[model samples]
Target chain A: MWDKRSDMIVHEQDPFNAEPTPQVLAESDITPVDAFYSRNHGPIPAITADDWRLDVSGRVERPHVFNLDEIRQRFTTHAVTATLQCAGNRRAGLIDVRPIPGEDPWGSGAVSTAEWRGARLADILDAVGAEDDPDLHVAFTGPDVSEVATPPQPYGSSIDIAKARSGEVLLAWGMNCQPLPRIHGGPVRIVVPGYIGARSVKWVTAITVIDAPTDNYFQASAYRILAPDADPGAAGPGDGISLSTLPLNCDVLTHSDGDRVPAGPVTVGGYAQPGNGRRIERVDVSTDGGTTWNQAELDLPYGPWAWCRWTHTLCARPGPLSLVIRAFDDTATTQPETPAAVWNPKGYLNNSWPRMTLHVT
Target chain B: MWDKRSDMIVHEQDPFNAEPTPQVLAESDITPVDAFYSRNHGPIPAITADDWRLDVSGRVERPHVFNLDEIRQRFTTHAVTATLQCAGNRRAGLIDVRPIPGEDPWGSGAVSTAEWRGARLADILDAVGAEDDPDLHVAFTGPDVSEVATPPQPYGSSIDIAKARSGEVLLAWGMNCQPLPRIHGGPVRIVVPGYIGARSVKWVTAITVIDAPTDNYFQASAYRILAPDADPGAAGPGDGISLSTLPLNCDVLTHSDGDRVPAGPVTVGGYAQPGNGRRIERVDVSTDGGTTWNQAELDLPYGPWAWCRWTHTLCARPGPLSLVIRAFDDTATTQPETPAAVWNPKGYLNNSWPRMTLHVT
Candidate 1:
């Protein structure tokens, strides 16, 4: 809990995974480093900027190792305001549908926005003479070894070469104009904006340009959407759809489930985030189980890759109240209506309309 | 009628707009030129390759004009097997929800895949020393004047500078390895793969780089998603979300509405297309009204930009049966349940679950 705030809703203690509360997430456009969600598969590794090194190899003209200073001095610094959401950001919704044992039930707070500053990964690739093949992938491996991974290997993941060279991916050493925190990616991490936070590997130590996606346990086996009945343990590599980008998702922040309030006017507020560089065009709230939907006012004060804050006001009567919310990106793609529609064995990407039931007095 | 086949479902006669039958569309992996859909706002212009010239201007170091031969010889030829979908491909579904006046009730035939070969638009932009501004837009204009415009202007539309430079947009002189047909932008047309077909301006005669989206009637006023209550007549330019990419949509091609079928073991087939560089990951078929769902087999024999053909077999009892189809892209974003949820005045992008009713004999 070195970098985590006391108010975080702790889901794990050994690997130190936790998410900020709803109020903390909605308080500012950029979440404070301490209040940002921390999702880690292994214990946080301790490394100083001077000691850390990034090894660049695989499908490159020449393999090279660069220290933090070399990376900072070689490439021009760039900053991108991006929102990163955990693949299991809203697993609590899926848990309510059925029992997903041995998984963290993350609420809606597992997403946060920060201004990440670093050298563009494209520039680094260009310097390393990385092959321009779109079929290749840029894989990253951190030093922290995860006991959760089969055979207990280091946490690793990858992104397609096209995304790596899109000029948005970053090798970051700074967050919110401050030195990167250990709980988050420390000295340098790959900040893959618009993709799942898992792809943005933290505590980076290696960058390999490979022909296929890294066969790391995290990339090949976990973070996939398998059939609901498929046993995850028996599943082999490349079994299910390996998730990359965050799906179109929104969450209500003004009220929590089972909260009691005086019956009258209720203003609901939330944040909407889209995947794959798409912008949130509209968000809708349904007070009566999605039979009818009312559009909410959308505000994207942050950059394109950040989340859009939405709010709507409606009158409520005294009784059990149900509020459901969904979002549409620029492509007009909406979320699945029910968790049962998108439920998987791993309990990942529960982007269904989050139904929050509250007791109104 | 000049470029359309006898089997085409003609929606308009003056502008010569039509779509091929489902059987024609499903016959081949690359849709035949005669079977491809044609959506025109004005009479097709007749311009031989010798008479055609493309003028490139606006935010560039120097304006340049090139004839068809020069364009073909100057840049490296690139062929993209892409699917072009009209924004109004599935407008009939929206028409079922509510009457959208002055719009063609297009069935799912407004989309077709072809091998488009031409010079890369990025090469053209690079040759003209185009300003690399992400905020700027690349506009294209054709020679055919439209009476539908406020004061009668040529058909025009635009894509973002980033997309134009992404190396996918093409100035095509060939379709399916044959000389481009007169009706489908014969001499030279812009083939913007993965975007709404309107952006692939047919009969392109001019290309301009600008700071903002073109104020052309089609780009600014038409092809947008307006509020259900907003009046198109009173709406000005930049009124609503101007559509660019295709939405995640699927269509049932094997059976039309109100069809008669056998009592058991019926195979339903269709196509699914995703927008903004995403791939169709799953397609679900529901025999009932979406209460239960079964997955369909997905095949993308065509390249990434082409439609994914899907099929599912289900048993039926003797009586009336209803089949609903929905698609999920790689991001797990599914279509809205009902057309009413996405109904607009222009009847564009009706990506709802297409419901087909059949009587089991």
Candidate 2:
């Protein structure tokens, strides 16, 4: 649907716009959704699930619309598997001494983990009836449109109404278990798994509900994060802040010292999360960085919003060292011991403290 | 060069192994070597720089070989940019179950950042001649060959000769500044920029100087790291631990809580490094994980093998949160707050403490 004279050109390498290309997981716990990673923002629209539908409408009192098998036989499906990460994934490690605009330079594969399924935006906002308004604010909208004139803000995002009635916000359709690929977001989309995939909107097509929260343009101009001194082009529109649900950060995104196994064995795996409703309860690791610490080994427990997997092991003797890891949750919270005091400037939410640097003989 | 009759049907959706694709860094500061994100292990070998050369040879007395323009006009080039990562950059966040076993399920794009350039393996081991037995060791080799077998010890990896005479290693031949790409390792490679890009050996060819380490198969059976409690399919090769440099990790890929700017103003950014000689310095950030910490904002000055970029800002408000970041070096050392203390099983070096989650609307 983008042939406005064939220039096309999306090729920004297109791993959905960022950093992936690492491969090697053959048969290791399902991540095959066409290799996931499609952080789309354009091109992928081509819809047709019998002309989709959804709709719902503002201040709902019953402003319904459904379609798509009447919202999949009027709700009740559910499934999870979590992991979605992409608040700009690894924005190429942002530094910008000068050049700093935006749009995918991601180096962490944006993040993926599937298994989704559908229904349950708290039962489709209780079948389009929701409207007790505690300051409402649901807003989704996607079927993607906009050819400039200030496009770049139709992707939409908004949440709050107690996390949209917190039934774990769904409306997905399927992923990992199939069905849902119109560049991901397919016949129905909006999983919000562990949040941040631009609020999981994809082809959504209206939800509204807002009473006073969405000034549109991606909630009043671009998913933001300014103010370590603010001045994102002189901030404007309600002037920033709308990244919907996520906080309790944890990111190690790979660190390795392995492959020596003779100093009496070693192990040290990673991945941890705690952005929404925080969870991750433990991951310590230290190969001399904390002096002495070592607990890692968690894996399997997911959903307080997903992402967890830890591991550790030690025994030394080789040369050049320094390996560290840290994490804790369930609310005791922890992690943060450097990055010179949390620098900032729209690089938003940089959780620090995880180091690796090895050289064993 | 694959075409032995050309049937070529590996295809598992082949983005190699796919999933975890998050690119989007138009530019915040470099990271654009074709958007950098590769992590190969084979396939992508098509050398021809007038039939490359290199050589050098053992306990040297002049076993010279050079070529590549006499190792680029008899040495002295230098460059840096650093940040090579990939110790399984975020191995699918460490797979919570049934995932973990030999390489490449990287979600964090296995890390990238370029700039490189060459000349200086301690100035070609001081013009081919160092081995007064400072415990020998040196090694290197690599025209890459090994589909298994060759065990009488002969692959390679060894460093101590006073860290190969310091001079920051090199032999690169550009990247980020261009040239060098035969899927990386072009007509000349070997940066060791900060160590651990598998010791920066690509197409290299030979360097030797040994007296001890060279059990090849990537230093005695694949760059090791087992024994957290061992048992990665019954751990072998003496049971693990042998990567050469890169530990002092810290990753918090990305976390969002911004939208233009308002609600106190927020910002957070990522990337840190310390492996091999170590040096990060500081990075703290905590939206409420470490209870209350905040220091992030480092960038530039990098040299313990490059990769620094940090940022932080906070004050937003509107529910759910968690954001943590930690990093240290210059000796304060740090990071180690969980991951079961540091479990092990060849998952090697897992730096901990970098949680990120946000939901501030």
Candidate 3:
């Protein structure tokens, strides 16, 4: 097992919400299991590797219960470096606008990059003889239950069957060349690259081909963007804005808030990630409240799902200042200039220009 | 005791943090005292109006500890309708960006309006006699303690000495013909109209004239705009950006989110508040991602501190849509298109184009 670091942020203890310190995360392209932020909804089930079995049953011509060894033997393994982020990763930014009574105020540590090795989900569906019609979905269920829910229900989510045929979704068992840690859904977890971490169900135990999305608590009520005053009990599936793709986001790891620097040159750096499979096109840095900006040097992405880190150096003036950073994705989308511009309820998916104000002493 | 309404949002217990219901807040020109939000930092100190005395302590030629009636008799009473909004209002939008780990996700409801009646702060300072140098501040300390602090420090804030002399600063004792409620600094409170609510210290007990801002926890650390990741413990007074003027903000209160309505013409209305003393020059409403905007009708403001409400009617087609509204202040500063653009760690002053997503089913 790769040694997992214990120094990152721990937003909540139960369900184990943790984010890697930006310093540690920015040091390497591949995030170690320990450094990876864990966005868990329920307690980690202690399923032994040998005892764990993935049951593929619903709407299949041939249902098969595949164990760890059987799963590896049945399909070829593929590896990809992907960045996983909690949909609520930057959620604290939204809550900063308006306080949401009962919720976690997450920090920038909720994302991590890792090399994942797994069997393609399409291969498993093909072997199971999928009989689902078009325009349907594949639902995955796990034993985890998000304590954030009103009644505290088991964890579940779904993706379009068309997405299943895309050959990107995987049933992963290895992370960064090590067996996935139990905190990261070791034994087996579904990896839905480019989508939010919620869609990538961890500790996945079953898959069902259905005509619609899963009716699980998270899928039905949790992820959607509800009104700030909207009651969770009144809404149902497909009733509000459902989050699917990740938003364009960037974080400055090299610098922290309230940091003091000499009134001269200093280097600033961070990682940039884009939605779906879009690559980051350019990054701009501004010290004068977006009045002017300088382009930063960007590294090519290792994979479509992984983040591209960037760096820049600028002369500082001795005064209180805000260092602003914004990134544009390949889709020609740029980060919003202000967090208040894209203010939303449930505090989901904020990719505005990130600003860190400090003093040049 | 004045009757406090039950419909407003209550953010914390013990030291209460509450805000009015948006709909109720926008209902009348002058908000009822019961509907006014109460933002308390510490336990309500037990004191009677007859026993309470304001201690005029630091750097005063004529130091006078005056009781409530004595203080009232020494100055002339004036009334003004002003809106007091917490600096952390709309913080939920910032928390939505990334979790701030340990903080509140404040909603837009963290603001309220009232007709505050009181003697001018200048009048009190005149009676106390003053000794001040240039580049100095007038610090106000209250019996209230902000629970956000670890040791529960008393609430304190400071404004420029020149600002203290602005005549707009009021040492208020009455609200809507009733003596200030105990929950709202009953005996007396400082109403710095147009500034963030933090500067309007409630339950005022002392005033200190100093060469710099107050060194108290709330003054030196809490209200300033520090970097999102900045440690609250490391900052001192004047180390970060200090907020004096309130930012321009608008809210849609008439139509709630997730509202079910027929696919036809509908009226939308709400309030628009300008930053500082600027008036709302215009309000633009967009039904289609701001491709086309229709100006809404605006009402003249009653006072500089009170909100100016507006209304607009438009036809809607049956579909999922976002009704976007943005306001421009007299200074030509239009609302930012996104919150991430202006995102800060503390989640203060989000004046973004508010968008409400709804379904016309």
Top lDDT prediction, candidate number: 1
Docking class of 3: incorrect
Residue B333 in model 2: lDDT: 36
Q: In order, what fnat does every candidate score?
A: 0.40, 0.03, 0.13
DockQ of candidate 1 (2 decimals):
0.37
Model 1 chain A worst lDDT window (10 residues)? A332-341
* lDDT of each residue in A1-361, candidate 2, tens digit only: 2211122123253223433332321123345665556666555677788988888877767888888887888677888777777666544444332234655445445566777888888777877788786778788888675332154455667777777777777888787777876777788888876567777888898888877666666656556654345656666665534555444444443443332333545554656776665576666666676645566777775465657766666665676557777665542334554433333455544455556566666
**Superior candidate under TM-score, 1 versus 2:** 1
Best by TM-score: 1
Candidate 1 lDDT over B143-233, as tens digits, reads 9999998778999999999899987899999999999999898989999988889999998999999999999999989888876667878
How does residue A273 of candidate 1 score in lDDT?
Answer: 87
Where does candidate 3 stray beyond 4 Å? A1-4, A232-234, B1-361
Models 1 onward score TM values of 0.90, 0.34, 0.53
Interface RMSD of candidate 2, in Å, is: 11.3
Per-residue lDDT, model 1, residue A233, is: 83
- Choose 2 or 3, whichever is better by DockQ: 3
